[model samples]
Target: MHFDGSTWWMFYDGTSRGRRHVGLATSADGRSFTRHPRNPLVLDAGAVDVQRVGGVWVMLRESGTGTLWSTSPDGLCWVDRGRLFGLSGASTDRFGQVTPHLQVVDGVPSAIWFGGASVVSWNRNRIAVAYPDGAPAPAGSGCTACVSAGLSCAAACQSALGATGGACGMPGSTDGSRCCACAPEGCERCIGASADCHAACVSAGAAGGWCATPGSTDGSRCCACW
Candidate 1:
């Protein structure tokens, strides 16, 4: 809820006909809100969060598929702005992404979202933050190995892994700035700096393995053959 002098604006998730959408309401006393003539301003999206930036009102909503945003001049009208990159492309747990919120850290706008693993949090409920200004923002903070790396997740993974004498037999998944190599069913999946999928396989005793599918959420289920 935010106040614009005379009217108080409230943005919330409103349901109608078994669908969740973003809605806006106005109140003069911060209570007793009157829904806008056009309720359910947003359709087919969840995890809606609203904020005003540079005199423009922006709304963010994310799900397993991806994260997206919209802009509004008033609080009621909106213009959808495609998917939210960066964190949106990151790994998603079984339930997609959840609890998306916004915060300003060190004067930078960031989005926070959560996702769970193993049907439950399983200590893997992802509570990660994404910065619109690229990750590791403010730059030049120790990790310069990727200063001029390629933009694709696979390229980044290959460059970093190759530099460490590691080779990936296939593509990898991206999480923020780091790339993780997910090998086939009989290989070890590793997510860390300069770790290649093939290297991880050999390290885990599964030699000459194939890379797993991109954005694969399958855990380390190695095959029974040494």
Candidate 2:
């Protein structure tokens, strides 16, 4: 939810027949919100985080397949930009990356989310953070890693994969691990460790095959198979 001077905007998700849909509502007093005429902005998407970036409205949503991003000129009409990041292979986020929230501080942007081994189990979940660009925070500043060699999850990611950010540890136990995003050259997006890239491409029967990118077009840590 965001407040733009006179109005408060809320983005929420609802389920119909087990499918998720993203919707928008607005209110002047931040209490009684009315759904927008164009409700359900996107299908099979939820956990939306909306913000204004460079005078344009940017929305990030968690699609079942992956996290997707879109851009809107008037905040009503949007154009899909495809997957942002998906399941990292780490124990903390192996099964899911849920409830993504974006925070911008002093012109720097970071994304935080819950990582869990089971999509339905919240008690064993852990909080994860990512910088995407690998800037500002020195490696291994926050969370701990499950890896060996005394390397924090973030540090290990940076050292081994040149990852921008990573986090580790869980709320109740020390079993949780961290996931990192590494944007490789030429790739437009990054595939999470758990994503079945080969199977997805094969199922889609893409004729152009796929390629990997070193960095994300939007400055996020990403690798793409296009």
Candidate 3:
């Protein structure tokens, strides 16, 4: 499905026999959709939703492990991004299927779960936002409002500078409105410049951008445009 901030759309295979691959459809209302083609839009994947991200691909396909166990620019591709962290291990499903958990807080994507084999070795479902020292704290518990959402106000401020062509490590914060305009890194814009950034933290035509990211100031970790 595609979410342009207002409408939700998708490509699905209607209920039938031997139905393989994707089909196109659009919806003004999320439930009912108009199918574009009766045949598969893109075929040859093992499962219907082998893997997919909302707004990053023309179609979906499941490649292999180590391909992208985590988030990347597009939900389909993963590579060198400015952000990196110590992923202790894949967060697993309660039944032990290795289904990790991910969420987007504020505007940054964060993974929260017990390092199963770590010191505590907890065996229960858990959800919390990240902390400055890389610890996990309950949501709404962080250095600032944005921090509670998994993004530091400093990163938010840096976003403001980047949007305006300022350099890193400078006093660049989102303008008075907390808008992190999509500009060059270390870029300098007015203190209150607007964040023309996509809801997922990238520009329209830039290379390597996150699409429909997780986490929100509202406490719902959904895949957002930024």
Candidate 4:
């Protein structure tokens, strides 16, 4: 569940009709929500998690041995963005990352998932946290009213900056009103700005990284090559 200022968005894993899928609902009070007419927001995908980064809304769903990701303009509709992360340790080598969640600590986006040694570590779940390399933290928190649900302001800000723009995390863009150029150095959840974040990526070894926004063409996006 995530709070988008005025409305609360709740995503759940359940069965509808005869198929197992993910569902969504919106509510003003956080208790009652109007189900989206387009039910089964995701098909055959489970362990769903949703987050808003820069000005984009991203959905992470488990697919095969890795996690599949998608971006949405409105949480109701989605477009595939492919795999976001994969696990390689002995415990999670087989199952990949499971039940991942995104949170912005201080400013960098953080990813937390459940992993452990295959059957040998059965029932012994290990919690892993992934984030940008240089992220400073208040540890698991972000400004609530920073970014809007549709991210209109972020889109506009990025559009105004054009290509070769710096990330929102650069210096003064974290008001949630503008989008980042690429993802920050240690962001596990959010996308960073291109000028700064990309530099960080290159410094981190993704010299030829490719960065783009997922849903909208506004240019407010994250770096994938990194």
Give Cα-based local distance difference scores for all models. Answer: 0.54, 0.58, 0.34, 0.55
Rank order by TM-score, top first? 2, 1, 4, 3
> What shift in Å separates residue 59 of candidate 4 from its native position after superposition?
1.3
| Better by lDDT, candidate 4 or 3 | 4
Pick by TM-score: which candidate is best?
Answer: 2
Which should have the higher TM-score, number 2 or number 3? Answer: 2
After superposition, the stretches of candidate 2 with alpha carbons farther than 4 Å from their true spots are: 63-66, 118-123, 136-226
* Model 3 ranges off by over 4 Å: 11-20, 38-102, 112-226
Worst 10 residues of 2 by lDDT: 193-202
Residue-wise lDDT of candidate 3 within 1-226, one digit each (tens)? 5655675656454435654545566677788877764445444332223223443332222222211132334422433222223332333211221222334355444442222211111223223222335546544422343322444444445443433122223234323344332234221121124232222223323222221222223312222332
Per-model TM-score versus the true fold: 0.52, 0.57, 0.27, 0.51
Clashes (backbone N, CA, C under 3 Å), per candidate, total 2, 12, 29, 22
**CA shift of 100, model 2, Å:** 1.0
Candidate 4: misplaced stretches above 4 Å?
16-19, 120-124, 133-226
Off by over 4 Å in 1: 86-95, 105-108, 111-124, 134-226
For candidate 2, write residues 42-73 as lDDT tens digits: 77777788877767787876534445688898
Query: Which digits, one per residue and each the tens of the lDDT, describe model 1 over residues 83-197?
Result: 6652433232444555566665554565444442212222334444455556553433222233333233333343444332222223332233443442222233343331335
Arrange candidates by lDDT, descending.
2, 4, 1, 3
